[model samples]
Target: MNTKKHWAVVVGLGLLTLSACGSSGGASATGSKTVTLVSHDSWAVSKNVLADFEKQSGYKVHVLKDGDAGQAVNKAILTKDNPQGDVFFGVDNTLLSRALDNGLFQSYEAKGSDLVKPEFRVDQTKHRVTPIDSGDICVNYDKAYFSKHGLTPPQSFDDLVKPEYKNLLVTENAATSSPGLGFLLATAAQYGDGGTSRSSEAESGGGWQAYWTKLKANGVKVVDGWEQAYNQEFSGSAGGKKAKADRPLVVSYASSPPAEVIYADPKPTTAPTGTSYGTCFRQIEYAGLLSNARNTKGGKAFIDFLLTKEFQEDMPLNMYVYPVREGARVPAEFEKYGKQAPHPETMAPTKIAANRDQWVKSWTSLVLK
Candidate 1:
């Protein structure tokens, strides 16, 4: 991949760490004391966060910005034998299977990982891929649009395709967008008979296909990326013009609501937008130690540190991603600006690992072509 028609930024942010590891390959310490963190561009936080971790632990940190989720894992696998970075962060459920099956991660669960939400915490293969944080990808409608039009947001996948919203909604292509893929998986979960991912063997694949056809028939303006789909396609931009600020409704992570407020210019005391529609798809993200790591002990500590309260709480505000911790408090902007997706879509990593390429290719040929 060229990412052929995908929301490059969403895929970049969502799967950032999964892209590649070993950027500064083999920059490990002589003894078992230092650690190299081959982080993705999406693997970010206040610089102080990393510094605090380093101070607590004597391990010297070597950090590098690799590519996105898939690329990071790809490089990790390629360099498995030589073992470039000690630890990798933010390889989510979508790429989990490939990361694990390729034998890229070493087994080491974090401390107090047992208290994490069961689904988010477990790496069944015993590979111990630690769940760092999780969030939902759902349909977000501008509150202004719904209120102004005297209409309610779509409650289900089918609601989106109804006549009222024929030209109002915008979505990214699946092959190129992580949010689009998340939306697709949600339909599979709803229609695909409760399966999270649509495999060839999955009966839900038909249901997923049916829903997509209906959505297509409803007249969605398909775009290649989330930025175009959200910032430009949806109505309710300050100008509300497609070319000017077209995207109002989009496929995005649940954390976006808070992100909007957090990232807003000059730092607003309150949020500027509202995500009143809770049409979200739950997505769980994980971190794994490259199968061949330069410093195994250091890798384990870094993963554990990611789960700590400081990191978990800092996640929502800094990275605009939710924390995996059971009782994390959301920022004011997140609670007010962000809304939840009640019925999120899901897919097991294994299923996605098997069919992602084929499905993406078919989708490209069928629709994007």
Candidate 2:
């Protein structure tokens, strides 16, 4: 959910081009049959998933878990001239345009690409990336804490800026976290401060910056990334126990409460928390063959495997994300507790790509500074 990583693409592309081109890192295979898949830390698969892929495709699979979506994509781009891995996964809609524009992928046209649902199939023109999963970034509130304080959960973006909610919210920095960027985008769309035309200044005009100014005055706590905001600060999550953070509101996924149940110490009969549907921000993840792969054939095969029923079916419970492939079964935990918004805010990839950097800049000035 860290869309903030894309800002690096805007400023670091030139350096990446030069540095990557000068290296021969991924040109030769270290092991004849081994094919590496580079992905973000959040990516997860069943224990034997790669082994199954290896058995089916006759290729040894190595997964390199990078820092986050933005970091992974940026690393891929920086190494595009000589890719360190054969395939790259975890570039979401927010970071998709930057990855595509940087020419980080090679056209593979994996056979199972058609199996993806129409709503999730984002890359039609170029066969560079294939949709694999989707999720909703939303604000999750501490059910127990809110009830204890006799305070109602915020119902909308407007409610967040109210005096009653002061010091009760914590969000990741838009410059470093994907969900942070997502929540910022939701506010931008809600306030008419998004898109390329708007300036990133509070005094210069009314837009995302102005909205952020009001949020800052409401005593919002801004952290570096989702891990800190959700795990260290949000009172609802067990992770908050580590830091004793009592902030009841945080930016997380709609499916997070269900995930907590699924991964609980003693599996819970029901979810212990809930998410605010009003804050949902749709994020779609994609995978593609990195250009100049040492094992292009294996890379294409891996992408095909990703879209197959086997991999898709393993996604929901393991990764806490919805599979993009049609006919993939949804886990019962998801059906029971995962919240979905009736109408989550959305912005075109083009507009987001064009305005993302400026919006983050404005948000930082208004909120962080």
Candidate 3:
């Protein structure tokens, strides 16, 4: 999951107006002691934890938030020759191949590479990027809405297309949002690209495309990004509750439920939302030293700091993501309300790289039309 999807709502409405921490350009123009980090809008850290990194590395951190994950990665690629910053963060598994294929990053394995969980590691031969955090993209339901209507919240992909759930779902655009793309990939993984197998009542012989046809027919709604879908359309989020959003089901991160509990005004005894685990897709986010960074040393050091225990443990509360570091402790709210799915849908990066664009194009034509 991209933290950009939930950080604003999780932390406070004040975070919604967050801007670039410092001016643009590399360390050479600013100063040798300055390190610039280019990332999506969700980048966050506790002041003390970051102060520790600054003290240990002797580099003042400057942050530049480009936009959502897809927009940020595309912008970084366009500016790769004279990149906006020394390091780039917030690129995820969905867009990893595009970043690597564009030669956006240089090879530099961080200091604590061994501490990262093995499953999260990629580009093993090149060390082009370091895995930072991970989460699951899944469908979430408004518990109160379901209970009030005497309806059981959907538990699986098959359940989403049933008549009872019609016109009740909302999702982000697959071509624009990371979680939206992750959800698209989840269906692709569940129903093979062109396989004729009918795995369930919701599945068709035509594979994922046919599944989308059913989803679209069920009156699924599409929005441009996660914030709009979750905050303005889905009824489960605190923002949605205030907005009086009607859709009860939304494509969001599995960790969203805990955020609802942790950030509520009165702080509910239990999460107000729930995840449909069967629809989950594993998402991993990474950071790397820009190919022509002016502050290579500072960038590498910052990447190393990301894997430290202190930084890893601070991530859940700040960014609403699971650290890739093996021993990182998750917040109690996450443990009690938002456990990761036991069997999230997954696909190899190589497979995603080969098919992602075509799938998105086809999905756009099938569902968005």
Evaluate residue 153 in candidate 3 and report its C-alpha lDDT on the 0 to 100 scale.
94
> Residue 213 in candidate 2 has what lDDT?
80
lDDT of each: 0.65, 0.76, 0.85
Better of 1 and 3 by lDDT: 3
Cα distance off (Å), candidate 3, residue 184: 0.6
Residue 262 local lDDT, model 2: 69
Lowest lDDT 10-residue stretch of candidate 1: 1-10
Q: Which candidate is the best by lDDT?
A: 3
The whole-model C-alpha lDDT of candidate 1 against the native structure comes to 0.65
What would the C-alpha RMSD of candidate 1 be, to one decimal place? 5.2
lDDT of 3 at 91: 86
Q: 2 or 3, which is superior by TM-score?
A: 3
- In angstroms, how far off is 142's CA in candidate 3? 0.7
Write one digit per residue (lDDT tens) for candidate 2, span 202-268: 3344666666787888899988877778778988887785678889998888878887776678987
Which stretch of 10 consecutive residues in model 2 shows the poorest summed lDDT?
A: 6-15
